[model samples]
Target: MSLRHTLLAAVAAVAMTGLAASAQAKTEITWWHAMGGELGKKVEEIAANFNKSQDQYELKAIYKGNYTETMTAAIAAFRAGQQPDIVQVFEVGTATMMAAKGAVYPVYKLMNDSGLKWDPNAFLPAVVGYYTDTDGNMLSMPFNSSTPVLYYNKDAFEKAGLDPNSPPKTWQELAADSKKIIDSGAATCGFTTGWQSWVQIENFSAWHNIPIGTKSNGFGGLDTQLTINSPLDVRHIGDMAAWQKDGIFKYGGRRSDSAPLFYSGECAMYMNSSGSYAGVKGNAKFAFGVGMLPYYDDVKGAPQNSIIGGATLWVLQGHDKAEYKGVAAFFNYLSSPEVQADWHQFSGYLPITQAAYELTKKQGFYEKNPGTDVAVKQITLNKPTENSKGLRFGNFVQIRDIINEELENIWAGKKSAKQGLDDAVKRGNELLRQFEADNS
Candidate 1:
């Protein structure tokens, strides 16, 4: 071969070798998440943006199914020593994640160790409080936090002769309005709900200054018992059961299966995660307004702040040291005001950082969007009391299922509200006891 051709081939070979080495040197960070549909696409976009912003790392977000399935997959993968660097766990799975000591790298320590300028106080209390240890140390990074809000059809309200701009603020007013809506045939049913256990029981107890369990709703310790059968709880559940018979309240199904009922104009109002804002905006055919979750005015301090739903980002163990720094960088990027505000504006999630919230307002998002701020206002309406803070019982995921089943039984006439709730408490306490023993 000629000397010129040989040198050219050598140069090409050297260049190819350099490219392969650079690719190998890039740190790949894996994040397993539960975000699905358009939300999942947004997750990918965020990851892609992060990848483009930095050359040292590449992030890959994989959908691991629903919240429960994502958590389960993470746990199983951890046991197999193959867990991702990060996982998205629902608020209900907080206890499970906390119990997996040595498996999780607490966000506080992660940030501090990485020498990042992280201020714990920068996060909104109502959202971050759920994933903090008793010492007030944050265990996970708050992401996609949301609370229940009242979503009403404005067109239906006007037809029913109710103020379209005003939604019911109290339980008594809600019932009266629901009757009016049904009687006037503005909608087939007055209202339906999503997340029956979450909205009906968990937030219900919190909003009314009642506890779902003792020991500060399991924040105090693992030894906690369900107080879900309280007098007020029974009364509320019984009222819902009665309303079901009169078409005032419809139990369309569980875990947001009923959301279509509201979006399709089958029901006039819905109580669901504020995260549903984006979905409702796209799907609903008529004008809708967001309102705070209704409270019973008769109860003193009844309108206590509501607790949050949605999930947090947990940094899992078993990744390389280089990857840890990448994880920290990714988290910092995710928490930046610009990124967070954009996410909140697009997805209807509560921006975890106070700075993000302020940035969003400064951007005139709430002013232009109207009811988009209802979740933030409702959850931050008052300082969270012990009852209003949040729940953290171990085995709560399963307990939530038991609560749902009992509620279904009550709605189906197999048992009264009081009896079904009583049974739920009894059955849930057994699981709590088991969790306590295992975690203790």
Candidate 2:
């Protein structure tokens, strides 16, 4: 009960306090995402799973507006030395992200640094090729890759006297069916598209195996030209223009803004990302179906694989070694088959790994869900052609804006599709050249 006992009690209390702090403290990793609504919820759910599964690290996801805003924030934050550990950048931002070599830690390098065994073959070639360097090293992890596909209202098709179970596989068939839907008054608009630049222009070239640009669509190098003015591209746009005149096709909005029209049953057919399934399933009042993106029946090698349009997770450079391990651990968790399969099922994004696809198949997810496998089949049905590999051009965000402006003029009858596209190519090419010069 003297000085010795008092000193011993104080030391024991201090030891207990240290143990408690060590037990409760957890390393936190910040993830900046562009998802909102249901997609945002799914991202949080995945993060929660990772947090619950391990005590070593905790992932914190922050939605940083849409794709453009997210990319801009990441760049600004990196400059300010306040960037999150992970940033979600869209497919269009691939060139921009790759060009920022000083700001990024290549996903392949991160995986290897963490000693995580990652197999490139586990991803769909078309999906992985978009985010990889020429040597096929992954620059980012494909988080929510999706390609354009057809969405149709079955009830509208039946009312239009077309086969509800069958969707048009060729551009000609789509036109004819769209006309029928319009004539039958099945829907206010026969066909509408979300992300006209992404689906019709960018993926149109890929699906028909026509080049969207030269220099390997910018994957080979940065000095790429806007070739959407090609004969085939012109022909396709011209047809769409003629259809717009006939009321067979309606221009929804610039980028994925037409989704609501389709979901509202105002449009009989819609063309958009496979990822749109989540929105459609949530909002569509009528029965719906999904099909492969249509191509020109007469085009040689038509119906090629479509390129991805979703975002990927890129690890920013300059973080400490401990933080890099946390990033790698989170990536590994996200890439696991169970996590990937659940994410694919919940969000309609295609699973990025082969193991995830196999796990989904084993779980009978496809059989029970019916349309869930459409993305996998569409992406893997054919090996990616030169055009189908993916587009990788500089200043693509501005280029897309230019394309939207030109396409809007065409839809408003201010210009012919051929005239509009030709002008888009000319102007877009000038911008591309300028970007090339500046970046190079």
Candidate 3:
């Protein structure tokens, strides 16, 4: 062979090797989340789908325990310089994540920096508002957003001689029907709730168009003070406390511990995150129904939109540029209408994007399911007032624990409703102040 032919052959071989290496180079993005059980499987399925759709990126999703544990782990990992590329922090952790200036990559900025197409207005306002900074830029990508709803056993309602189709709409009616259910021995308890602080106070205030704190529930500034000890709050909490004494309202353990009470038929009514739809549907032996949360009939502008409860996906700092690109691609894939709709329907979480919600409706999913739209309607019925948008208090996880302690006192009859709530406000405000000081 001639020398020129040998040199040409060697150059061709080198070029072929470079092509193979480029084909094999793929970015791996790590996502740490809180979903467990069936939901965790769904999260894995989503990651699998994203992985299969492209050869340039692979998503590795890890379940890091519950919401609090997941957030704590991410923060600890961040401090240790081993944080995951993405973390799912519950809605209560929004303020904390936002305050950690150097710890997070704001979702809006991340998408834009990666040149991904993102529309902040395409998402449901109430769902996105919780994670948005005061400047209106979204800090996290909403993943599994939900609102509280009323769940009832249809058979239990019928046995109590009440109309199964007509669930209670007002608190007064709820009280009357709850008494009927108990007196007729249809269930061991009339009603029980999970996340007492979430359902009974935070959401309760938003649903009634009452401010939970002085500065738009802390969305305005970190200096906000708790105003949850007002007359309406006192009246509602006191009434629930009174009902506890009369055996009408049962105090189940906090944070979805009471879900079994309804599913096992021990409680006639249950109030919890709409995400509980999956658990109740899977476990209930009898027919069940979902309804909008009950509210006071006489309060002006009452029955306003309820706040969201689920978590969002936060992109953490210190990841590679390639990983951020992969993260942006994954987020954009998740935001697609088909993917978002499937996640919403399968997981019983509210569809976070307007397109997803409309796509679900256009597909006739709501018509086929009947009451599955209750959460959607309840959250979007009115433009969110300052009170209805959502809460963003600092150190909110601890504040919720403090409020739960005070509420437990009310349930145990150790303190009156007014006193317990007042004490919660006082203690919670101190933590807020401390958080402000620490973060400021």
How high a TM-score does candidate 2 get? Answer: 0.92
List the candidate 3 regions with Cα displacement exceeding 4 Å.
1-16
**Mind giving the per-residue lDDT tens digits that candidate 3 earns over 269-334?**
999989888788888899999999999999999889999988999999998899999999999999
* lDDT score, candidate 2, position 30: 94
For model 2, the stretches where C-alpha displacement exceeds 4 angstroms are 1-25
The residue pairs that clash in candidate 1, if any, are none
Ranked candidates, highest TM-score first: 3, 1, 2
**Which candidate achieves the best lDDT against the true structure?**
1
In candidate 2, position 19 carries an lDDT of 94
Residue-level lDDT of model 1, residues 211-293, one tens digit each, is 98999999998999999999999999999999999998999888889988998898999999999888899899999999999
What's the lDDT for residue 136 in model 1?
Answer: 88
Per-residue lDDT for 71 in model 1? 91
Judged by whole-model lDDT over C-alpha atoms, candidate 3 comes out at 0.92
Backbone clash count, each prediction separately = 0, 1, 0
* Comparing 2 and 3 on lDDT, the stronger one: 3
Winner on lDDT (1 vs 3): 1
Per-residue accuracy of model 2 over 1-440 as CA lDDT, tens digit each: 89999999999999999999987888788999999988899899999989999898879999999888998998999999999999999988888889887889999998898886767677778789888888889999999988888999999999999999999999899989988888899987878998999988998998888899998888888778888988988888888888887878888787778887788888899998888887888789998998888888888888788888899999998788877998998888888899999999888889998889999999998887767788788888789877888989888888999999998988888988789998998888888888778887
* Pairs with backbone N, CA or C atoms under 3 Å apart (clashes), candidate 3: none
RMSD of each: 4.5, 3.2, 2.1
Q: TM-score winner among the candidates?
A: 3
